[model samples]
Target chain A: MNGVRTIFGREIASYFTSLFAYLIAAAVLLITGILFINNIGRSQDQVAPNPAAIPDFFAFALIFFAPLLTMRLLAEERREGTLELLLTSPTSDSSIVIGKFAGAWAYYTIILAITFVYQVILLNISQGQTDLAHALCAYIGIWLYGGACLAVGMVFSAATDNQIVAAFLASAALFLLWIGDRVGEVIPNINVARFIRELTLQSHYASSFAVGLLRAEDIVFFAGIIAVMLFITIRLVESNRWR
Target chain B: MIEVKDLSKRYGDRLAVNAISFKAQPGEIVGLLGPNGAGKTTTMRMLTGFMPPTSGSAAIGGFDVVEDSFEARSRVGYLPERVPLYPDMTTEGYVTFWAKLRGVRQPAQAARAVLERLHLDDRSKTLVRNLSKGMRQRLGLAQALVHNPPVIILDEPTIGIDPQQVIEVRETIAALRQSHTVLISTHILSEAEQICDRVIIINQGKIVAQGKPGDLRKKLNAANLESVFLQMVNKDKRA
Candidate 1:
């Protein structure tokens, strides 16, 4: 537990020290802000089309940006030849993996939090007439979705030492998970398609929570994905120690 | 303090560290001398529990490296070839983090003492990325020593430091011999000769020679460790 905190603190400090974190934050905020403004400008239904759209934008944006945040968590350390320092430490591989994953998750959460300025604007314009429950549910879903994506990206970061390869692999993996259901639809087997859709980022996050309905299954599904992904990451790092 | 038996490593088809064995008792500074890609780093990695051996066993302080790694790791301090560190963290912060990760009970105090011993107390607040190569190396040593482990494994502890810093590191290592067992790897033969009580010359993933530096020198009938090392390495390649 202490080892995990040490690694987590180091990774989080490193993120702010470089330009990559700043750029990711700026890009996510700028893109989301622009999308929010456009949605408000084009609003014809007075309630901003869907209260969930703001959080939805964040979940969608994370498909591209969250991987960028986590790409170097382990891979860049290997590339820079510092993984030797890290791996040689007495800490367990799981602590290192979880620490790094948590750092990236915290960073993405901060980015998600900053977008609430859009919600404030929406609420102010309508004078408390907005659907606060629906907006909260969507926010919760986005939080869970982003957490899962960060875990998946962290696993890719552990598998390779090349930062570019890690980044590409992470992005590709998340992209598949994000759109796996749509791709699954074309397959001939219904069961396989159902499994893919059920396991996908979009499938669990889009319907119930997005519209103010907190289904127990959606929450469980996202939590399971995060746990399973982190477990795989831990195993990957441990294998490196032995290999 | 350390033992290995038939330890080997394979990266795909190429054998990085072939089946070989050696031992280091307490209070010995065993210098691992090898050319690049000669598997010194690989062997060190295995001993430190960073990488697993393909078909062998490594024991540190009687604990199997594979089975009781956490216990083995807790008793050893490792400094890698390149000295990876978080550049953004202050020197104090960096060592403290390492202490904590290594499960030091009083991380703050351990960090302070190590930093002071390494001549880094004044620079404790400086970000590691901004430190010079020598200072960075010192910081690396500080982290490794923070836990006060009985075993120290350093992979080229003075790779990029200036001459003065190299001398300082050597002196520090020499002083450390009073209490700890040390394993140091270096391509710089003279550095090994200066500090190592004994030297192990590895080539093509095998130990070609092992003994005190002077004994190896006398056996080879060479002027210095460099020539003896060269002769052995060249002979191994031809074989």
Candidate 2:
């Protein structure tokens, strides 16, 4: 739809024009680059070397970085008062939410793609002994993990006008999803604890795809969270008129 | 054409708009005049379908603003109290984006014509953040007019603009009187007196007076609408 394209275009344009995108990109890339050079660079193993380590490192890093990237998706517009212009237009609420999600997802994908150079360099020097499929699988997991984190961050962004509050709330939310299984283990009902564990970020993505096993259900879980978060977000914005 | 009957908005217990009712037909420019905190913005928001009325109904071209919000909104253009804009976007980009969001066919052409009509052609490529307050106000007006909607609700369109820009904007609005029904809110009594065909004066969320500006002035036995407004509110306080 033209509405989707228009909103998504503006949202993506802002990511390039605003400093938040650059900050997140710089921070994530800097930390990842440092890890690539320090921990993975000094390895020569054919099995458990840099290829194996970089994916795990980036996956963990994205769990922390994606929230920072998505913290201002909608919250900053409310804070700056631009949400009024968007809301008063003839566009539907779902279009706005989907547009925003697509834009943020595209930006994070770009950032993730650039980090592929690290994999290339490690491959080039190692005579192509690296398991590309394994790395690809972890990359997919990271993308899905980032997507889920972005959805959670977007929900927090919609709940408030303060960017700092949104950021912290998103961070706190992702942290809970990251550790839900660990926290659930101490409970009385073991089945309930295992179900709660299955709901965590690491349990869902890393346990399966960390070793490059691509399960349809794991992919569905991340996509499902994104869909649900956006649904709730659209409903929240629509309710503002009534409230 | 617009009609609002017993429209009210209450935020938790404090009433913002209290059973206000009015109507304005096609080819009319109605001024919503009120002091600060008089629910002028709230009323405009309800009419534009940005906010729902607590109790009562608003119909724009016979479409209910609440029940038929999307259909009602499709025919209306709203400029909120503060011009909320993406500062990073150029004037042209901002207008085109708004037009497309409002479902304008070929938004690029609409944006170009609207900018030219608003006398913003020279600054079309300039970022909105770099624009002056007057230019930003014009940009806001340009976005509101981009879709060529039937009804235009402008909340304090002239607020904080320089005198020269105010005259330019007033002239622009007066020119728009040929096609679209305009609802303008302003605290500036003289500007409203010059531009509005009918004026609704609200005080404390209730309509205290309504008539042509000149008629209201003559009825209150005052020199201008400001003096008449003061007398009406003063009389209400004493009663």
Candidate 3:
């Protein structure tokens, strides 16, 4: 929709203009780069290096970076009272939510794209022995996983007017999702543990694209999370009119 | 044309707007006069489709705000009390963004035209954050008028601006009377008396009186517009 595109354009422009976007990108890249160097540079002599190490580190870093990137998406608008203008416009609530979510996702994808240099570095370090197929799957998997995290952050951002509160809530939610499988490990019942593990983001990533094994169910899992989070965000933003 | 019928808003147990109804004829400037918290903003919000009414209805250009929200909203432009703006954007970019959102055919041209009308063309490239409060207020008006909508709702458009800016904004609103159906809310009774063709006085979320400023003054037997407004609001409080 035209409204969506307009909002998306404004959002992306604002993100680039603000210091928040650059700060998050710098931090994510710095930490991820360090982790990449530490892992691949230090583990060269191993018989079979774990190809999943860099992607795993990237995913873990996104749990924090995604929230930082998205915390201001809606919360800042609400605080500045721009949400009133946006809502009062002809634009639909879903369009606003989707535009904002898509804007953040697109920015996150750019950050992820920059991290591909780490992949190239890995390829060179492995002396052409790096599993390019596995690396490709990891890239796809991490991108989707990052999208899901950004959507989750958007939901929290829509829930509150305070950026700090939005950031804290989104980070807490992402942290829980990241560690859900470990929590599942300590559960007493086999069925409950399996269900919790299946719900965990790590489980979905590790079993499928994290290891070059792409499954329809895993892709669906990430898509489903994105859809549900964005849906909830739309509902929350819509309720602002009534409240 | 803008029409509202028994529009009400409730926040928990408190009613922000209590079945208030009125209409602004095509190309007429009507002022909503109310004290702070007297529900002028809430009513405007409902009419603009920013907020749904707890009951009743509002329509703009024959489009119902509740049932035909997008259409109704497209026909109306609202300037909120706080002059909402994206501080990072230039004046031109901000107005253009709103114009595009409102579905203008040529957003850039519309934005420039509105800025020119408001005498803001010279500062179009200035970031909103760096502008004076008065300039920001004018930018707010620029965005509201960029789409050339038939109905305009402005809530306290000149609240915090300087006296000169207030006059400029008032003049701008007066200029709009020939082309747009405008509803302006303000607690400043003199401002309403000077500009509004018809003024609606609300107290405690209900319309206390509404008519031409002079007719209301004559009926209330008050010496001036301010006295009439005070007498009405105070009389309601006494009751």
Candidate 4:
């Protein structure tokens, strides 16, 4: 536990200190902020616009954001030889994995918090017209979805010492999962389509959380993905000793 | 205390460390003297618990490096061929991070004290990226010693530093001989002759000879370990 805290503290401090993290934050804010203003800036003549589109679109952008956030977490360490220090230390491999994943997640959370300014604005502009439950559902869904994506990126980061390769692989994987529902629609069999749909990240959060639906199984889906990715990452890091 | 028996490491078809065995009793400075690609790094990695032996066993303070890895690792501090540094971290922060990972009771204090010992206290606030090569080498030593582990494993501890700094590091390591069992790998025969209580001359993944420098000097009727090394290798045509 002390290992976890120490690693976590260092990671968080590094994130705050590095220029890359700020570049990422500025980029996310630019995109999310633009989308927010564009939606609310819609004309009076148009049909009532769904304000939830901002967070939903942000979710689609996570195909890139999460990987960018996590690409350097392990890959850079491995390339720079710092991973040897971590590996040879007394700390358990699992603690190292969890601490890094948490560090990235916490930074993502701060990004999420910054983007929440849009929600606050949405609530203020609507003056009770906005569905608070709807926004809350979307927030919950995006948080877990972000964690899953970061965890996936972490696995790739551990797989190679190249940060670019890690980020590209994670993006490729997220892109496939993002369009999975569309691919499912073209399939001939209903059972196979349902199974594919069940596996797509977009299907889980966008369908349920975007419109104010919060099902237990949907939460489990994201949690399951996060847990499995984290488990695989821990194994990859531990392989330094045996493999 | 450190003990290795029949330790072997295979990377695919090649055997990087081929069933070599050695021991370092309490407070002895042992040198693994060899040229590049002599499996010194691989053997040191196995001893530090960074990698498992492909065939045999190693122990630190009675704890097996593989089976009791956590305990074994907790007792040994390792510095690899390349210094493991986070360019973003301050010198103090870097050592403290390693100390905490090693579960030291007072990480910051330990870091400061180790830095002071290495004559690096004034530079503690500098980012690791800003450190000179010699300072980086000493920082590596500081991180390895911050936890004050029973066994210290250093791979090429003075490979890149200036001669003056190398002398300082050698003295620091020699001082450690009073309390810590130190295993250092070096390609410089003179270095081994100067600081090591015993020199293990290894080549092509196997130890060609090992004994105190004086004993091997007289045994081979050579002026230094370098010629002794040449006599043994040239006379036997050993790999």
Candidate 5:
């Protein structure tokens, strides 16, 4: 746990010092701000409040955001040979993977928190007509959804030393997972496509959290993806010693 | 102290570090001399617990590197051939980060102490990207020493640094022989001959010769350590 804390502290500090992190954060906020106003204008005709604006935009935003934020997390360390320092230290491989995941998740949370200003404005303009519970559930879902996405990104980051390759691979995987459910339309088999859909990033978020209904299975699905991806990342990092 | 017996590392079908053995006692400095592909880095990597050996075993400060890696790691400080620094981090933050990773008590103070010892206290707030090549090597040395470990392993610490800084770094390393067991690998046989009490010459992933620098010169009947090294490496290649 000490190792985790040390690595976590270093990673957070790295994020704070880096221009890349700030650029991503700024881009996400700018795009989301535009989208929030656009969504609110459209929703005013049919409804008094629209709380899912942030999370809905984020579902697409995070596909790129998660991979970009995570591309340098491990891959840069390898390219810079700084991983030799971490691996040679007393720190365990598990601690390094968990620390990187936790750092990215923390950054995502901060960005997500900033977008809450949109919700506050909605509540004010609508005279508190906003369904606070609905927005809260979506926020929670996106929080874990973002976590799962970052963890998946880390697996690719750990797989390669080139930051561009890591980002590219992670984006490809996230894209597949986001749209994997649509495969059922082409496949004749229902069960297989359904299984593949269950393996995606969307099914877990769209049904339960997107509609303001939090289900146990969806929460479990996100948490499970985080755990399994982190596990694979640890394995990949450990395999470095062998190669 | 560091101890090893038949430490071997294999990468698939190729053996990068063949069965080799040596030890460095407290207050002694041992240099590992080898050609570029001669496995010095691989041997040091195994000793530092960065890589698990394919067979055999090593112990640092009485703890086995494989079975008790955390204990062993905490006792060993390693600087790889490349000076690994996070260009974004300040000098103090970099050393403090390493001190924390090594689980040292009062990491800030330890970082300060090491920086001072390395004559880097003045540059504590400077970004690593701005540091000169020599200062970067010293900063790397500071991280290796922050834990105050008994065993220090440095690989090619002077490879790219200027000659003046190389002398300073060598002076610093020689000062560590008071209590630390230092193992350094370098291509400059003259540098090794100056500071290393003993050296292990490796070729083709095998130990070709091992002894005190003076003793090695006498036994190999060479003009100097460099000539001795070439003769041994060539002889090993012909074998």
Candidate 6:
């Protein structure tokens, strides 16, 4: 537990001091802010606004932003040879993986929190018509979704020593997960298509939590993904000892 | 104390370290001398528990490096050839991070002590990226010593540093022999002759000779340690 805390503290401090983290945060905020404004303008000319607009935008942006935040978590250590020091220490491989994953997840959560300013603005503009319960659910949903994406990014980071290669591979994997449902729509068989759609990240968010409905299955899906990715990351890191 | 028996490492059909065995008594400074690709780093990695040996075993402080890795690793401190440091962190921050990782109760105090010992106290707050090559080498030593382990393994500690820094590092290693069992790998024969109490000369993944430097010199009928080493390695090459 002490090892975990030490690694987590150091990793989080590195993220705060690095230029890459700040650049990713700024880009996410700017893009999400623009999306919110566009959604609000459309809402004024139509019926009640879709409460899922901001949450949906945040989730979509995470496919890019999460990789940017997590690409350096392990890859940089390997490239600079610091991975040797960490591995030779008395700390367990699991603690190192979990600590690094938690650090990246915490940074992503901070960026997610910043977007809530847009939510407060929306609450005031909607004049109490916005369902506060639905907004809160969307925030919880996006937070879990972002955690899952970051875990995937961390797995790729552990697989390579090059940060750019890690980022590219993670982005490709996240892009596939994002578009899985759309690809499923073109499948000819109904049962197979439904199975593929159910596996897509978009379907889980759109059907359950994006519109304020929280299902146990959707929560399980995100949690299970995070667990599996982190497990794979641990294995990847442990393989260094054998090599 | 350190012990090894028939340790071997094979990297995909190529034997990087052939079956070899040696030992270092407590308070001894042993030099692992070899040419490039002579398996010096591989042997050190096995001893430190950074990597597992393919066919043999090693123990540090009487704990097996593989079966009792955690305890063995806790007893050893290693500085790799290329000093691994987080460039963004200050010297103090970097050393403290390592001290904390090793479960030091007072990490800040331990970090300060190690830095002072390495003559890096004045640059404690300087970023690692901004440090000169000599300072970085000292910081690397500081990180390895922060845990205050009973055994220390250093791989080519003076490979790329300036001559003055090399002298400073050699003195530090010599001083460590008073309390710690030290195993250092080097290709420089003079370094081994100057600092090592005993030298084990390896070539092509095998130990060709092992003994006191002075004894080897007298036995081989060589003018100096370098000629003795060249004769041994040259003999291996001819065979």
The digit string of per-residue lDDT tens for model 5 on A1-243 reads: 998998888888888888988998888989988988887888768855557778977887778889998999899888889999899999898999898889889988999999988888888887888898999999999999999999999999999999889999999999898888688888889999899988898888877798899999999999999999999999999988887
**Clash list (residue pairs), candidate 4:** none
Q: Pick the candidate with the highest DockQ.
A: 5
lDDT of 4 by residue, B45-87 (tens): 8988888889999999999998999999999988899998899
Over A58-93, each residue of candidate 1 has an lDDT whose tens digit, in order, gives: 767777787788777878776776666677677777
Tens digits of per-residue lDDT for model 6, B1-239: 89999999999988999999999987899999999999999999999888999999999999999999999998998999999999999999999999999988899999999999999999999999999999998999999899899999999999889999999999999999999999999999999999999999999899999999999999999888899899999999999
Distance from true location, Cα of A131 in model 3, Å: 0.8
Question: Could you arrange the candidates by DockQ from highest to lowest?
Answer: 5, 3, 6, 4, 2, 1
Poorest stretch of ten by lDDT in candidate 2 chain B: B230-239
Candidate 4 per-residue lDDT, tens place, A1-243, comes to 887898889889999999988998898889877777777777245645465676687679899998998889889888888888888888888999999999999988888877877777777777767777788888888898889899999999999989999999999999888898676559988889888888998889878987889999999999999999999999988876665
Residue-level lDDT of model 6, residues A147-238, one tens digit each, is 99999999999999999999999999988888887865688888888888888777788778988998999999999999999999999998
lDDT digits (tens) for residues B1-239 of candidate 2? 89999999999988999999999878899999988999999999899888888899999989998788878888898888788878889999999988888888899999999999999999999999999999999999998999999999999999998999999999999988999999999999998999999999998889999999999998989999999989877777787
Q: Which ranges in model 2 have alpha carbons more than 4 Å from their true place?
A: A37-43, A50-52, A120-128, A181-193
Candidate 3, residues B128-175, lDDT tens digits: the string is: 999999999999898899999999899998899999989999999999
User: Positional deviation of B208 in candidate 3, in angstroms?
Assistant: 1.6
C-alpha RMSD for every candidate: 3.1, 2.3, 1.6, 1.7, 1.4, 1.4
- Pairs that collide in candidate 3 are none
Score residue B160 of candidate 3 by CA lDDT. 92
Model 5 chain A: which ten-residue window has the lowest total lDDT? A44-53
Q: Assess each model's interface with DockQ, reporting 2 decimals per model.
A: 0.59, 0.68, 0.86, 0.76, 0.86, 0.82
Estimate candidate 2's alpha-carbon lDDT, on a 0 to 1 scale.
0.85
Docking class of 5: high
* Pairs clashing within candidate 1: A82-B84, A242-B52
Can you list the residue pairs that collide in candidate 5?
A: none
Q: Show the lowest summed lDDT stretch of 10 residues, model 2 chain A.
A: A44-53
The Cα local distance difference test for each model comes to 0.85, 0.85, 0.89, 0.89, 0.91, 0.91
Report the number of backbone clashes for model 6. Answer: 0
Off by over 4 Å in 1: A30-49, A117-127, A179-196, B10-19, B234-239
User: How far off is each candidate at the interface, as Cα RMSD in Å?
Assistant: 2.3, 1.8, 1.0, 1.4, 0.9, 0.9
For model 5 chain B, the run of ten residues with the poorest summed lDDT: B230-239
lDDT of the structure predicted as candidate 3: 0.89
Tens-digit lDDT track of model 2 for A124-154: 8667977777777888888888888888888
